[model samples]
Target chain A: MTRIEEAIKQSKFQDVYQKALVNLIYTANCLRDEQVRILKPFDLLPQHFNVMRILRGRHPKPVCPGEIKEVMLDKANDLTRLLDKLERKGLIQRNLCPTNRRKMDITLTQAGIELLEKMNHMMEQTHETLKGRLSEREAASLSHLLDKLRG
Target chain B: MTRIEEAIKQSKFQDVYQKALVNLIYTANCLRDEQVRILKPFDLLPQHFNVMRILRGRHPKPVCPGEIKEVMLDKANDLTRLLDKLERKGLIQRNLCPTNRRKMDITLTQAGIELLEKMNHMMEQTHETLKGRLSEREAASLSHLLDKLRG
Candidate 1:
């Protein structure tokens, strides 16, 4: 039996597809839990961390809240509220766009960039720990399968 | 490029291992978003639906909140609050355990069971939509990869 079977205490599935659905949800929660533990000490939720990464990825290039929402892992988040929290934390700055007065342009503060750099180092260790069990080929294969599953 | 690349708007990764980490988290969130959309009309959050299903899985056999926590997909829930919500909705009942006065035994109400039955039919359709892209072999392979990843 797979670890999922043991976790849910159920060995029977209607089919492999059904089992895959359960396995995906269960494993994803496990991954999110690990991230939550790692982020707790840094006072960051996953959504906060995700937004920081998106900003850092486009550092020096301002992005609007709409763009961040498009790329956010959890689409259900209240972007305005999240941005307000980050702005209060001094991790991000939101200002009227120079190009379009109606739009708000968001950017990472220097403090935010530094904090993300520190967090990035820790996240590297986390990625290693999470993916260490799979071989390089296996990791690639896993990613390929996930992409196909989403198609 | 994979659908993930398009979603995140990034084409580069440090390595396959790193790519896999992003892929897993990203794919999991996509799956969750789908669930959220489907569950919305039922006025059920995923965690609520999850708890109801757990109750149904072991219908007639009472389970405590602690036992439910052990098997929940999202382990970080404030279970007591969650139970209170279910109880308020009249979908569940928590009775003082006959054998152990200090403990509570939780079970699904007839209303809860009936609701879950309806949800289950809907869920089966959701599962098909989510996993429909993959063949049987691919589904099995995907589940195996996810289990291996958690290891």
Candidate 2:
């Protein structure tokens, strides 16, 4: 038995607090699995999806890599490398910002927009699949609690 | 604005859901960041910590690589590589199981145990730091809801 398994077998929680930590980590892992499957069909990882979404937000207006990094869901180690991959795939275009020599503006290509649109329904479907397990109020409360936890 | 930022700015329900997804991913990333910091001083990663705990669970009795994978919180792609790293570090030993020709049993070294003891306190401290954000009941409910969502 693993320590996790042992923990499960032992029922060692004196209170609900400890149990919550385990549950949070476990559920996040489970949700990630689901997201990964959905993303696989698009040949995209979650991080890629995140980047595309960021670029699409700026749509006509191009934004620099530094800004994207700031808002990125996960603070990626190598923005240049990740952007290079996407640019090589022709999903996005990178241009040098006129005002800032060091900053490069990134914009999604038409293919990227279309890909996101195609994936949007599936993403919604995935969310809905999990939604049945909790009420709106419960989900809202849960999100609120998570935010508080982070804060 | 990035697509995600616009999603947040626009309050699109689908976008909101995506934001929630990002929030979960980001928060977990931050938690791992903390774990990485703690583990770094000991020259470990979260996955390594996971392996050590598994070995400790089956302390006296050796466990097979397959069994370790079964209980690992993160499903690793290459167990052989990970085991090799641990073995090279002198933290674990692998022996072919007598009963099962294909199976290799893994056991932790005293060095592994001592390192784990030192790191466990740091993990608990990190958890405690986050614990202050939510009340005990809220945490339990959050866990319950997350489990239900995953299910």
Candidate 3:
């Protein structure tokens, strides 16, 4: 039995398909927990960190809220609320779009940029730590399988 | 380049490890979205369904809120709120532990069991659909790689 099978306390699966489903969800949760652990010390939620990453990726050029929503890994139904919290933290700012008065353009503040720089390396390190057992070939194989699974 | 690379529009990853990290998170979110699509019509969130599954697993034997938290795939910080929602939905009932007045014992309602029974086969079918591309050996290989990744 795999570690996930042991953790869920269900040794018998109807098939490998069911076992793989359970394992995927379980490992994903673990990966998310590892992210939460890293973000917790920084007083950030994964969603919060995710928003920052989006902004950082589009640094210098402000992005519209809809654009961020389109690319967010986990869709936040109430992204406005998350943006409000980030705004309150002074990590991001919204400006009236020059071309359209009704639209707002969102950009990262200096603090947001600095914060992401500080956290980015640590986040990468955590990923490396969690995936230490897998070689490059293994990692690629896993990615390929995931792509195939989605197809 | 994988579908993830195109989706994120970032064709170059720092390495295979980094690519795998992004792929894992992205694919996990996709899996969750698939689950949400299935549960939406039933007026259930994944968390609610998860709680029900836990209760079903321990049917006839009531479990404590703390015990539920420990075994939950996605740890809910405000379990009381979730319990309150479930109670309102009439899917679960909380009884004061006979042995300890301060403690509460949680169990699924008859309605909950029936609802799960109705959805269980569909849920399993959705799992099969999502993983249809992979053979049993491939599924096993993916699960094994995920286990190693989490090590």
Candidate 4:
């Protein structure tokens, strides 16, 4: 209780549901912040890592900016500048999609994949460490509850 | 599975904890989007609501910008502009601190409290609706797992 209470510096929430919402958001931010810190070594922001991850997941395949935007975790933010930066860094390639000439297809370069793979194990280890406090059953329950929360 | 899967357009995750992290973040964003929608009517963003709620909680006690930033959920974001906006809107007041002449004290105006009270029932209904899917036990379990995850 003190961990979270102290993290946000406020013990009392408006109510249980509100408390849960804040906890969920706060914890997610903590996770995001950790990722951001980890990514800082690579001179990348969380949103930048997010795009790289999306492109990496689509490896050997190509996606357009719109497609990346569609699935982005931080949709409120615009990714044009980040894309431009990644493109300049030679971590990503942007070209006219053959299928849709008007659409710009964003693809991860070899360097990008290498970079992501370089960070993959560390990220997995971090996630495992961050999640180590909960048992498998608790992790499953947390996922289930979160899925149900949106419905 | 289709809900979260389809929203992100990716089906399988590498592991359960990873899946849970994604789910937690996705659901928190979902909750945030809902709050944004509700807050739209009031022309207030979630961060703004957060500040108002914070100031309202400290009623009769003036707080400085540093104090508010210390407790803000999205502290990474600069609050000076937000404070400026709220001040311009007459929802919040900022003045020189009597105790610390160099520091600025921020507080909610009467209209701010009124505005918050006006939305209180609606916000509670939103939370109630969001929490409706889970039982109290499940909600408690979700909160507990999150706390443990951060431990």
| lDDT of candidate 2 over B1-102, digit per residue (tens) | 223334234345353444455656656666677788989987778888888887887796898888777767677878888989899999898898889889
Across A1-151, the per-residue lDDT of candidate 2 in tens digits comes to 2233242343455356666666566556766787789889877787888888888877979988888888776778798989988898899999889898898989999988998888777878877776676676766676677677776
lDDT of 3 at B86: 85
How does candidate 2 fare on TM-score? 0.89
The alpha-carbon lDDT assigned to residue B27 of candidate 2 equals 61
Over the stretch B1-151, how does candidate 4's per-residue lDDT look in tens digits? Answer: 3356777888898878888888888887877888888889998899999899889888968888888988888783678898998999899989999888989999999998999997776787877787678887777777878888888
Question: Scoring model 2 with DockQ, what do you get?
Answer: 0.43
Where's the lowest-lDDT run of ten residues in candidate 2 chain A?
Answer: A1-10
DockQ of predicted candidate 3: 0.59
Candidate 4: clashing pairs of residues: none
Q: Which residue pairs come into collision in candidate 3?
A: none
DockQ of each: 0.65, 0.43, 0.59, 0.62
**lDDT by residue (tens digit), candidate 3, B16-112:** 9888888888888888888888888888888888889889888979999988887777888999999998889898999999998888999999998
TM-score of each: 0.93, 0.89, 0.88, 0.92
